[model samples]
Every structure is written in structure tokens, then in C-alpha cells.
Target chain A: MSSDAELIGRSLRGDTSAFVEVIRRHETAIGNYLARRVGRQAAEDVLGDVWVAAYESRATYDRSYPEARPWLYGVALNRLRRHWRSEPAEQPAPDLTRLAHDWDPWPAVDARVDVQAPLRRALARLKPEEREVLGLVAWEDLTVAEAGRVLDIPAGTARRLLHQARKALREAPEVAALLQVPTT
Target chain B: MDEMDLMKKLSDVPSPSPEAYDRARAVLETAVAEPVDTVVRPKRWFSWPRAGVAAVGAAAVAATVVMGVTGGSAPTGTSTEAASPVVESPLVKLASEVKAAAAQPGDSSLVIATKTAPDNSRHVYYTLYTDKGQIFTGDSTTLASSVTRNDDQATPYNAKVMAAAREAANGDVEKARIAMITAANNALGVGLDPAAADKAWADTQAEVAETFRKLGKEVPAPRPRPTGKELENRINNHLWSNATYALVVGAANTEVRAGVLKLLATIKEVTVGETDLDGQRVLTITASPDILGGNASAVLTLNADNGLPIRDEVFPAKDSPQPSKHAVVSYESSRVSLADVAAGKI
Candidate 1:
């Protein structure tokens, strides 16, 4: 399969199908990225926008990175920040914990009793940067360096932020209890 | 549970519907279908299609370094210039002459823009267009990058004007006129009557607002369409710019060139002046201040014999929004076969 950079290079020429291929490869990952930040409902709405923004700026994408998932995560995060700031007070934005419980693809995970509230509270307590790096690494399955790239921060900073977040999660009374609770 | 396990358990957001992805893809394709050809616009950036910003007085010096200037033209008056023998109109006579002349010898149109400013840096553009409307553009003077349309050199502007040019070539001046202007600004193709104009204005405002909305930015209030003389001036301004682009881009094609001349002949606001440069005669086509909304005016210089566009300029008036940003862009066109272009031979 052609790399995302190769697809983008094809797009800069007149062939738009190459770009559609790039989107096909990453849309689900990007859709989930938005879903995790905004609720699933809002994420679906914003998914198209993230794709458009990514498509418009694809010319500037660095070809060195073999994977576009990290770059796409960065684009998704920027759109997410804008979505957060622009969302109105009365409008709907379900919490990730609620969204997770509402619909889980995995039968075992869906059947498992929800212990997300304590972790959510603990995650909320961390600094925004720490939470961002932690979520990217733990939730998005990115390496520390990849998370740093997504956040536009250094690998060292992302590692430190991840460490701080993990330590805080360990110390939080609510999260510590959830960790002690047996997983079926 | 470990931190990774704990986070994984929390992040099971439902997948978006396939329809959602399809909607986004359509928006991108809409943008792609238009002239995203080298134009990098941010979400909120609303570039007025009619408003032209290019070179004027100082651009002559730059033109001299590149194309070699002889006698210069201020291009102030529209009424007095002989592009050819005394006929009903100078432009009409020139158009007839060009139409009669053989099309430039090339399977494709080779349009070059060699720009030099005060910085002493040199940049050249070679844009080659097939009669079929495929475009190959690159910065190499040798046309080194003008390979296949699937190559990185392929772009999307000449195709927009190709059909319009073909129409003009076929002698449907009115249809070509509409096509040229509308291609420049899609909204203008609609009627500018009170009801039609209002609807077009509303559509434009909505599109601009949607762009901002998509970027998650505050939507700006739409400006009301201008009334009375203000609307006429704006219309003329766009008409002039539209005609100018069609004329310049399609200069290599005999029918497109003659068709643009016929289209320009209809616009009362557009005036022609003939002048000599380096003993070679050329025509200075001017759109005066009255035609433009503000004091700003624009001029396009053309080769008198064959009607090839040489230099185009915008002299921004006192009330112009961007005086410092004005530029002087010149053109030099030649003929080359597609076979040679594909081979990277100039």
C-alpha cells in the first residue's frame, strides 16, 4: 500500500482519488479521535470537517512520517479545541464515560460494570497538557514521541506529562479504589 | 488495572455513520473541482473574485528586465488606440486580424510568467494546456515538470477557461462573454436584477458564513448588496477582470483570442489605446476609474499584431484597500508540442 505521503503527493497533482484513499485509511481513527473528545453525536458531525481541513492542508504535510495517524490526530485535536470553545452552553455534548457506556463494540467490555467515573474524575484533575498527552498515548495507542507530535510538544515533555498523569491517577483515592476492584 | 487498560476501557466511542464520512468527502471534492490551483486560502479568507490586485507603474522596470521594454504606456485613456487599420473599433479590427491568422504552432498553449522584483530574485512559471483542457504547470523554465496530468506538475485553471475559449472561437460571443465572467466569479453568471441580485447576494453571504462556521469561528454579518451606481461599478469591475483573464490565458488559441476580443468589444467600460514599444506596436486595454468601484484602475497590454497579452497591471486608487500589495505581472507565451512537453523539452 502507498504511504499517506505518497497519496498526498498524488493529490497535489490533479488526481483527487488519491486523497479519498488517504481519508479512507484514517477516517475511522480520526472519527474515534473526535468521538473521544466530543460525544459520538458531535464527533460524527465534526468528522467531515476534520477531513476537509486535513485535505486542504495536505500540501504542507511532511512526507518523512510513514504513518499519517499521528498527523491526523494533531489535526483532529485542533478541530476539537475549536469545537469545545464554539459549542454553546445549552447544546448537547455527552461525557466520554456516558458515551462509552451507551455503546461499546466489545461484548465483554460492554458487559463489564462501568468503573469509568473515578478514572474520568481523576483524568479531569490532571493538567490539560498532561491529560492530552496521557489520552493520546493510552487511548489513541500512540508512543510518547507520537503523542508529543500530536500535541506539538517535545517527546521529553510528553513523557513527563504522561508520568505526572499516571502518578496522579495512582494517588487519587477514587481511581486507587477502581484499580483495587477485581476485573471479571 | 494499569493506566493503559483503564483508559482503553473508558474510550469506546461509537463509530460515526458511513453517511457522515461521505458528506465530508463531498465538501472536499467540491473544493477540488474549483480552482484550488496554487491558491492557498484559509477557511475564513474570502477573496473577492472581482477585485484584482497586481502591478502598475513600478512594474514597468521589472517588465524591462524580463521582457525588454521600449516605449512605455500609462494606459490612461481608453478611446484612442489603433490595434489595427481604421475599422468600426480598434479591438474589432485586431480581433478580425488575429482570427484570420493561423493559431500559434503548438499542440498545447505554453503560458509563461517570468516575475522579477526589486529583490533580484528570478521566478518563472510554465503552464501548458491541452485543447482537451488538461493542464501541466511547473516553475522550471525548461518545462521540465510538464509531464503527465497525474504528475505533481498538474494543476486546475486552464481547464476552467478552455470551454469558454472554445465557445468564443465558435462565434457565440454572448455565451462566451457569460462563461468568461462567470468562470472568474460563479455568482455573476446569475442575473443581477433586484430579485436575482438579492438571491445571489444572500447565497454569497451564506457561503461565506458557512466557511467561517466550518472553521468554528464567529460568522461575520453579511454586507448588503450595493444599490444604484455602486452595483453597476462593481459589475463592470468584475466584467473587466473576467474578460482580461480569458484573453490572457487563451491567447495561444486563435478562436479563444478572437472570441475574447469580440467579448471585450461589447463592454462599454473597456477602452483601447494603441502604443509603440521597441518599435513593435501593442494595444493598451484600460478599465478606467469610473468602471472600478474605487479610484483603482487596471490595464492589460497586448501584442498589436497577434493579440498576445504582454503585461497586466492594477494601479490602485487612493481608497484602495491594499496599495502596498499591488503587483506588475507580465506574460510571455510560446508554442510547444505535447510530445516535447511530456519529454520535458521546452
Candidate 2:
């Protein structure tokens, strides 16, 4: 299989089918990325725009990176912002709201942590960037540096944000139940 | 579970449905398929009318400009209100009423477009449109679970036409006409000053002359600048086709229908009259064979109240043995949920 970088390079050469392969590989990841932030319905609508923007801008892709996933996330984020900007300022971006709409806390792992109130409040209270880095790492399973790449921030800044975010989560009085879980 | 692990568990979302992936892919593919990105400037239809040439013979420059269903460039004696929307026709004024009517509420638009063949058989397409400006296509009449979803594809032209229609919702009909024509083919709307337009038309004339010369065909006499009746025909032709283009893609849009109704009113060649169709009042708007650039004529039947198109047809010149050049089309549009449509509820 061609690396995403190789495919994007091929696509720039006019073999558009190569780009379609890159899309098939990362579409699921991109879908989850948008769904986490904007809900599924909006995600579906914006997903096409992301692909259009990505394809048009493929000439700018830095092919040194074998993985296009982070680059794609960056593209998806730009489109996501366009969707969000249409929304009023007070309605915080929907990153955590998708959870409020769909998450019923996992009772089987440990029913006591099922209290979503503290988790939601704790997540919401962190400065927007810090919460974003945490969500990218925790939910998207991206490395701290990879999260930074998606946000176009330096790795050290991303590390600091993650650290602050974790600390906030641990110290919140409302999050005591979540932290009390014995670390493996 | 660790806090990060807990966050992970809580944030899980379903993978995008195949329909979602197809929709997005279609957008990329449409861009890929276009021969050139027209962002710099809209390209003139490289294909142009070889009309009046002894060589290529009647191959109209594929135009937003009309040369359909009729023959010749002679004006059909309709006077020129084409330049401006002054002296509001009763039909054109109805646009304000239609525009003032509240838009129907819906997140998704469902349009079932049916095309009838000369043989009398029909092909039906089930298309779902998003407010976000995407369309999913399906062909089943009564679909099973296996065939529940629409095929993802939206031509960029369709998006452009609908966007123009939305913009027309409040603007003057003349401006709306130009917007719709430009949306059809960006080249037509650009360079609208009389001098710039005539120069472009002259350049097209030279190109036409060159095309005939290259083919070793005898060159037709040079067409003077497309002015008066000729310019009116081109503008009118582009408007009619683009308006049909808007309705076919987006009749579910109240503003689109209203805009099209308003703009269509301005085409004097388009005659609108009411008729009784099985005890129901319907308006039939016709483009006589003369205006279609030849002998073929177009008729669009609409609901008397809302102006939504019920059926649209084109018939070849009355004497021509060739079957009607275009497939006869009709449609039903409604508000529906994407999930329900995906689940085969329609």
C-alpha cells in the first residue's frame, strides 16, 4: 500500500484515484474527529467540504510525513470552524456537547464514575486550547505531538496544555469520583 | 479506568455511514473531473456553435446560451424588457408574494424526479438534498434495506445554481436573471458593459470563423456583435436553462422556486397561462419553438398556488422525425429526514 504521502504526491501528478485511496484510509478517523466536535449530522455535511478543500490544496501537502491523518485533521478543523462560526459565541463549540447528547456513562467498568456532571464541568472549565489537546489525545488516540500538529501548535505547548488539562481533571472537587479509580 | 480512558469511552461516535463517505467523495471527484479550475475566470464553452457553417453544421457551441428545440436567431417579435425589469408584469409581481410567504422548515429536502422516455417508459430518481448543499441520489421506486441509501454525488454546477437561486430570493428579477445565467456559465455573466460584451461576442465570432476555416468548410458571413434581438436571445436562453437547472436540483427550496418563478416571468417568450388538469388548477409555462433556437418547444407545468414544478417537457420541431431531444421530466419534492430516507422510509 502506498503511504498517504506517496498517494498525495501521486494525486498531485494527476492520478486522482491515488487520493481516493488516501481518503478511504483516513475517512473513518476524520469522521470521528468531526463527530466528536460537531455531532454526526453536521459532521456528514462538512466531511465533503473537507475532502474538496483537501483535494484542491493537495499541492501544499508536505509529503515528508508518511501519515496524512494529522494534515487531514488540520483541514477538517478549518472546515469545522467555518461551521462553528455560524453558531453564536456563547454556545461553546460542540466538542463536549456530542458527549452530552450521546454519552450515557459506562456503568459496567465502574458504575460509580457514571456521574457525568463533574466530568463535563471539569472538561468545560479547562481553557479551550488545553481541553482541545486533551480531547485530541484522549479521544482521538493521537500522540501529544500529533495533537499539536493538528492544532498547528508547538509540541512543547501541546505537552503543557495536556499537563494542565490533566491537572485540572484531577483537582476538580466534582471529579473526585473519576480520580478515585485506582490507576493500573 | 484512567481519566483519559474514561474520556475515550465517553466520546465514541459511530463511523460515518457509507452514504456520508460517498457524498464527500463525490465532491472531490467532481472537482477532479472538471478539466480546469475556473477560479481564475470562467472559460468560454470551448465548444461553440458551428451554426451557419457549411462544414460542422449546427453543432451549437455547447452554451448556457440557448439553441435548443428551435432553429435560427431571428427574434420572435417579443419586445425587450430583457434589459431591465421595469413595468412589472402581473406574473413577475407574484414573486414578492411568493418570497414573502414563510419558507417551509426542514433540515433535509427530498426530491423524486421522474424522466419519461419517448417510448413512454419512465426512470425515477430519488434525491435527498441537505441545507449544507449536498445531494444523495437513488433510483429505486420502493427500496428494500439493501438499496435504502442514495448514491452520493452533487455536481458543482447544481450547487452554484441553487446558491444563485437563494440569492435571487430578494433581489430584482433582472439582477437575479444575470446571477442565474452567470451561475450557469460564469463566462456569460462576466463583462456585462455593452462594449465589453460586444467585444467578447466579436471574439466569439472570430473563433467561430476560425473553427469553420480549420475544417476547410466555407466560412459563414461574420455575425455582427450580438446586440438587440441576438443578445436578448442569448440572455433569455441562458436564463431559461439555468432556471430549469435550479428547479430540478432544488425545487424543495422555497426561495429557489420563488426566484425561478419570478425570473421566468421576465422572459416574454415564456407564456404562462392557467389550465384545469383533472379539476386541479395548474399553470403551464411554454417556450414556443421560435425561442428555443429552433422548432423544439418547452413546457413546464406548475402548481397554481406555490409555483413548484410538476412536469417539464420539450418536444422537437413539429415536423422533425427525430424524437424529442430531451427526456420529459416531472418531480415531487418534500421535507424529510436523512435517516428516514436512508432507512427506506420513502
Candidate 3:
């Protein structure tokens, strides 16, 4: 089978069916990406816009990259940003209170006591940019280089952001306790 | 937890439903096919139409001014209120009421509607839309029915029309109007460009003129391209008719029904009056003849207390083949459980 890059090249040359194939390949990943950030309902609404934007801008895709997943992520991120800005500030993010529910993987009872609570707080405290880069690595399974491409930042910058985010989490007393990491 | 562990937890967040993914894919496919510059955003229900009225009305005034200066005999009998810049809030209030009623959760929505066919036979349809997205349809005349779980099959209404109504009710009236306009263009197979008003007018006029010529009728003298007001009115008429159909046939959810009501309120050409339906007091809302594209007009009668449609009446145009005939489709809606529908209890 031709690669995603090849499909996109064909799409740019007027083969819309090729683009549909590309969408089918990435829809699940992209849907997951959106659901995680914006919750499922809003995520579904944004997903359509992401694909449309990607299709319209397919001509500008850099063919050097064999995979279009990172570029698609970038498009999704831009749309998410726009959605976030447009939304009223008073509206709370999707219910993450469930995150603290009993799903602790740690064997120790003491360690199991609401580890996700502090982790959620720690995740929220990171600067938006750092959180985004960390999310790409941790949640989306993107490498620092791939995350950099998604965010349109240099790989070094993405690495620095990810490192900063990890350090911030480690420095937080609650997070450190949850992770059982000794504070320096 | 270590970074990998934290990442694992994050990944544990539930994925979007397959249905959502399918819907998004469909939207993307449709959008890609028709490459328009505008992005379809979730509209805030009531905000859209107010702005639309101002913009379209301004264009109409500008067109009128240009015509006067050029010494062209301006068309007589066009409503000057078309140029009125004030936004009416009565429709907005009614829309809110309808939307509130629609939001009440239910297992299934049952629509009992009777349509008078061109052959003068009245057919009653029983459509049930479950909250689970399943649809069961039956009719009185044919005694024929089917059950399907497809979203597209739940209602025979236009998706775009329902979407516009939903947006309008959600307070994006202007966005809903744009959506309606887009739907109208799609239905008419004419591109009504917002930026290129003259071109839209020229294309529409040319198409109409050609149709007239094909009928061997004398083509009238060519006129100036339609102003934004005229175009807005045309689209709003289409929107109103489609919205009415959606309410009676396809509105499975209250939000959608409410949106259609809200969108309907934005059209100034529609007049709201009071009448008796089956000896019960109802509000009768009628669209103007011009908006309906002929001498015939559409009247939607709704239960005043609940805002649910009671009946839909289509008055035949003066030149219509059935000039003396008018069609009335009465509606009865209720909440029913999915199991009951499955058991054929409806």
C-alpha cells in the first residue's frame, strides 16, 4: 500500500477518495486526541473541522515526512485553540473528577490513595505549551521530535518543554508523594 | 507515578463513540466535496439572525438608493420594512420557550402527522425516534412500517435544515441563517456567494429566465440583480419551509425542534396569529407569499402552551393546479419508551 504521504500527494492532485482513505486511517487517533482535550461531545464537533482544514490545506503538506499523523495533529491543535478561545471562561473543562476514582495500579494501599488527584492538579499547573508537548508524548504516544512537528516547534524546544513539565510535576509536593520521588 | 505511568492513565480516558467518528467523517467528506471557504462552526442560537437582518437590510437600502440615483423605476409593492434595521425579539422569546420544551428528556418522540397528498388522499404517518437513535415508522393509510437504527433513517428531514434549526435554537440565529442559505443553494443547485451578491443574483435570475423560456412563456425584461435583502428573504423562505418539515417529520430531539422555532422567529416575513385547532387555542404562524415563492403561503399552527406543532397548512398558490385546494397536516406528538416502540405498542 502507498504511504500516507503518497495518499496526501494524490489528494492534492485531485483524488479526494485518497484523502478519505487518509482520514479513515487517522480518524480514531485524532478522535482520541480531541476527546482527551475537549471531552467527547465537543471533540466530535471539532473533529469534522480538523479533517476539513487538513483537506483544504493538503496541498501545503511537506511530503518529506512519510506519515501525516503529526501534521494532522497540528491541524487539530489549531482548531482546538480556536475553540478554546471562543468558549466562555466560566465553563469548566470536562468532568475529570472521575479520574480520582478507584483505579490505582500501585500495590501499596497508602500509595493508592487518590494518586490521580494530585496528578490531575499537577497536569493542570503546567504552562499550556508545556502541557501540550507533554500530552503529545505521554498521551498521544508521540516522540519529542514528532510532538515538535505537531506543535510546529523545534525538537529541542519540545524536549525542553517536556523536561520542564516533568520537573514541575516532580517539584509539586503532592505529585512527588504520589510518585514516591524524593524531593531534592 | 513515573511519566510513562501518568501517560498510561491519560491514555485510559475513554475514546469517542464510533457514531461520533462516523458523523465527523461524513461531515468532512461532504465539506471536502464542496470546497467553500467558510468553516461550519457550532452557532450560538439567537445571535445570528439579528446580524443577518442588519446586513441584508443594509444591502437592500443600498440597492434602492442606487436605483433611485440611476432613475430606474424602483419595483413597487416591495415591503419597505425589508429595509427596517430593528431586530424583533418576540420571535426570540417564543424560540426560547420552544427550545425549553424540547430539552425535556424522553425515551422516544412520537410524531403523528397527517399529510394531504396532491391526489387529495390524507395519509397519516407515525414516526418514533428513540433516544438511542433508533427509528420506527408506520402510516395509517398503507398500514406499512419499518424499523431502523440508522441516524439518517430516523427522519426523512434534511440534515442541513435540522442542523441550522439546532444552531438557531442554541442562540446562533445568524449562523443558522447562513446554514439555511447554504442549504438553499445546495437545493437550488445555485451558488449564492455572500461576497459576490451580483453574481448570485445573475445566476439565479438567469436560471429562472431559462425555465420560463423552456415553458414557451414570454420572458420579462431583464432586471437588476437582487439585493442582499431579496436574497435573504428568498433563503429565509426556503429555511422556514424546510424548518417546518423538520419540526413535523425529522425533529427527534427537543433541541433540534427548538432550533427550528428559533430560526423561524428570525424571519420577519412570517406573521404570527392566534387560531383554533380542533377547538383548542393555537398560535398560527404564516410566511409571506413572496417568501413562499408563489401566491400560496405556509401556515404552521402550534400549541400555545407547549410550543409543539399542532398542524401544518399549505395554501395552494393562486396559479397552482389545485388553486382551490389547500392541504392540512395535523400533528400529535408524545413521549414513548423504546421498548414499547419495539413491541409495536405505538
Candidate 4:
């Protein structure tokens, strides 16, 4: 199979089928990324625009990069920013905990304690840029350097942001308590 | 929680549903089917000053609308022989309207169109055309206040359409129709192959089938090779569809609008009627059913006063999926000067 870069090259040459293949490869991850930032409903709405935008700008894709995920994330982030700016002011914040419904960290005996709530709050409290870098590295499984490319920032900047986010979470009272607990 | 656990939780979201993926793919397919020029350029963040200038220019043009600098030729009824109750062909009536509208002078034309998708989401576009070959466009999210150039091409598609319309504006309707057809074919990248027309069509069918297989779509059964008048009709229909598309998307030029109306009139099955669109008397042109196969019908509504198109709608066959789903695009147009647009004076 051709790499994403190769497929993008084909797309620039007018082969849209190749671009469709690229979308198929990354839609799941990109969709999840959008859902994490906005809610799932909004993510679905923006997904198509992102794909179309990416296809249009495929000519600008850096062929040196073997994978197109980071570039696609960059496009998705831009779309998300526009969506955020255009959203009505009265809209409520997205509930990040929606993703954790399938897995409960606390068992029956400890169910009374909601361990995930503080983590969600801390995640929300981080600076927007910091959260983005950290999420790309952690949730998206991209390297710090890769996240930097997505944000169009220096790798050192991305690394520092990730470090600051981690340090803040470590110091949070709720997160500290959870870390101190024993784990199997 | 530890970083690993935190990461795992963050990544635990459910994947997009299959329906979502399908809808997104369909959007992509529609976008790709059109000319590649529709690709959107990524916006630069530090362009506020430029945007401000454009906004000022647009405001100037809006203010000038009251001055009547954006005037155009009014639609005139076609000449009729004395005591003849013979009804004019729909094409002839529409052609006459286009000619009358083309007679009115304007420096530029503005067009606003909205496209509604199967999901019911609407994408609105605003376009402006200057006689000197500059095109400006915006959308509902970003109105005409911050219009951008249509493209880097010196002679954009709109200008080309306008030039062709002007060429055909001469009184000879038959000659004008031929010119419009040639222009539409050129725009659509459809070439004439007199010597090997039959073989060329056969090869085209094979290529289409191959493309379908590559895209994982079912290969559709190929019809018998057309010959003589059937082949001629097929070719003309293909060109007609292309011309109609160009007209819908880029008919801001008065002459181009006139040319399109004339070209559409040439199609025997296209019927013209009078109706009210938004309280304004308008001429409606409805394409014959099955003109483009699948029993689809395309209807174009034009402003009866100046022969400008107000809407273009396509209704798919009933048996097809989502029979109620129709593609509708509504248009709004004006005339302005290129110099004013460039100087931030509107």
C-alpha cells in the first residue's frame, strides 16, 4: 500500500480515489479528535468539511512526511477553531467524560468516589494550547515533535507545553490522591 | 491518575458511526466531481488588514446600489408575427428574455447562491463579477463583506462564460447556440472526436467501469453503443448539462446569463413558464426528465425583470434513495466596477 504522502500526491494529480483512501485510513482517529474537543454531534458536522478542505489543500502536503495524520490533525484543528468561534455564546461546554462510560475505574466498593471528575476538571483547566499538545501526544499517540508540526510550533515549545500540563496535573489535589493509591 | 491511564481514558471515545462516515464520503465525492478550482485555500491568520480593506470595498458597492450604477437591461418579450396565435418555443421565449437583459449595461454582477445537501445543511455562496475579468466570492459564514478573488487565473471561468455569451448575443439564435455549446464543452473538458467518436465513447465507458471497480463501487451495466442521431443527441445532452452547470455557478455576467438562456432554449424538451419567486416575477426553465438519466429533472428559476437566474434545483428519480432529497441553489446578483473593488472604493 502507498503511504499517505504518496496518496496525497496522487490526489493532487486529480486522482480523488487516492484521497478517499487517505480519509478512510484516518477518519476514525480524526473523528475522535474532533469529538474530544467539541461534542460528537458537532464533530460529525465538521468531519466532512475537514475532509474536503484537506483534499483541496492536498497540494500543500509535505511529501517528506510519510504519514498524513499530523497534517490532517492540523486541518481539523483549524476547522475546530472556526467552529468554536462561530458557536453561540450560550452553548454549554462539552462533557469529556462521555468517552469514559464504557470503563469505570472505580469498582463497586469504591464506586461512591468519582475519581474521573477531578481529572476531567484538570484537563479542562489547562491552557488550550497546552491541552492540544498533550492530547496529540497522549490520546492521538503522536510524538511531541509530531504534535509541534500539527500546531505549527517549534518542537521545544510543544515539549515545554506537554511538561507544564503534566506538572500541573501532578500537583492537582485530586490527581495526587489518585496517584498515591495502590494499583494492581 | 497517571499519564498512561489519563491517555487511555482520553482515547476511549467511540469511533464515528458508519452513517457518519458515509455522509462525509458523499460530501467529498460531490466536491471532487466538480472542477478542481473549487478547492479552498487555507486562510492566513494575520490578514485582518486585507480583510478590512475588502469589507470597506464591499460596503462601498452596497452603498452604490442605490445610485443605480449596477443597472442591467430589462427583459423584453420576443417579437411575434401579426395575428399569429402560434405559441413560441420555451427556448425562444427565454432566449428573447436573455437578449433583452443583456442589452442593459453594467460594470459587474453579483450572485448569491445557496446549496442544500441531503442532510439538510445549507452552504451559501456570494460571487461578484467585473467586466474587466476579476471575480470576487464569499459565503454565508463569511458574507460578501470580505470577498476573495475567484482564482489566480487571469481569465476566470466566469469571464469566459461572459465572453461566450457576448459572442452569441448577436441576433442569430442558431449561431449563438452553437457558440454557447462550444464554450460549454471547452469548460467541461469535453472534446469532439469526429473520426473515432464511437470508439472514443466505448473507451470512455470502459474507463468509467474501471474507475468504479477501483473505488469499490459496483460496475454498472453498459448500454449499447449509440450511433447516428442517438449519438448526436447523447453528445448534445452531455454538453447541455455542462453549460447549465457553468451557468448556475458562474453566470454573473449579463452577456453570460443571456448566452446561457439562449443555449438552454435550444434543448427541445426544456419548457419555460412564468412564476413568482419571493414575490418577484421570474421565468422558470425545467429540463426534461431523464435528460441526464436516473429520471432526474433540473429546474432553473430566473429573475424575469433582468433575466438573472434566481435558483437552480435538481430533483432525483423517485425510486432512488431519498427521493425527496433535491439539490437546490438560489442566486442573487448585482453589477459593480472592477476599479472600485480593487481600490477599496466598492
Report the number of the highest-DockQ candidate: 1
Best by TM-score: 4
True contacts kept of 3: 0.43
Candidate 1, after superposition: displacement of residue B246 in Å? 2.9
Candidate 4 Cα misplacement greater than 4 A, ranges: A1-184, B1-9, B12-107, B130-150, B153-164, B171-195, B209-222, B226-240, B319-324, B339-346
Off by over 4 Å in 1: A1-184, B1-88, B117-120, B149-160, B192-197, B289-295, B319-326
> For model 2, which pairs clash?
B48-B61, B49-B61, B69-B296, B70-B293, B70-B294, B70-B295, B71-B293, B71-B294
> Which candidate, 1 or 2, would have the higher lDDT against the true structure?
2
RMSD, every candidate, angstroms: 15.8, 18.9, 22.4, 13.5
For candidate 1 chain B, the 10 contiguous residues with the lowest summed lDDT are B64-73
In order, the Cα lDDT scores of the candidates are: 0.59, 0.62, 0.59, 0.57
Per-candidate TM vs. native? 0.51, 0.48, 0.42, 0.55
- Residue B249's lDDT in candidate 3: 53
Predict model 1's lDDT versus the native. Answer: 0.59
Q: Show how many residue pairs clash in every candidate, following the order shown.
A: 4, 8, 16, 5
lDDT of candidate 3 over B1-346, digit per residue (tens): 4865765675654678898887677655544432111112111111111121221222322322221111111121222322223266445566667665535555777788766443333446676655555455555321122442221243222456667766776755665765654453432222333334444445545544553454344554556544456645555555565577557654556766777767777678888887777778778888765565444577788877666788777676676542323667778887766655555565
Residue-level lDDT of model 4, residues A1-184, one tens digit each, is 8999888767755575788899999998899887766657778888888887777556556666889999999999876655544455575435423322222221211222234776766666677678778788888889999999999889999999999988887777766776785322
lDDT of 3: 0.59
Error of 1 at B15 (Å): 35
For model 2 chain A, where is the 10-residue window of minimal lDDT?
A104-113
- Fnat for every candidate: 0.51, 0.48, 0.43, 0.36
Assess candidate 1 and give its TM-score to the true structure.
0.51
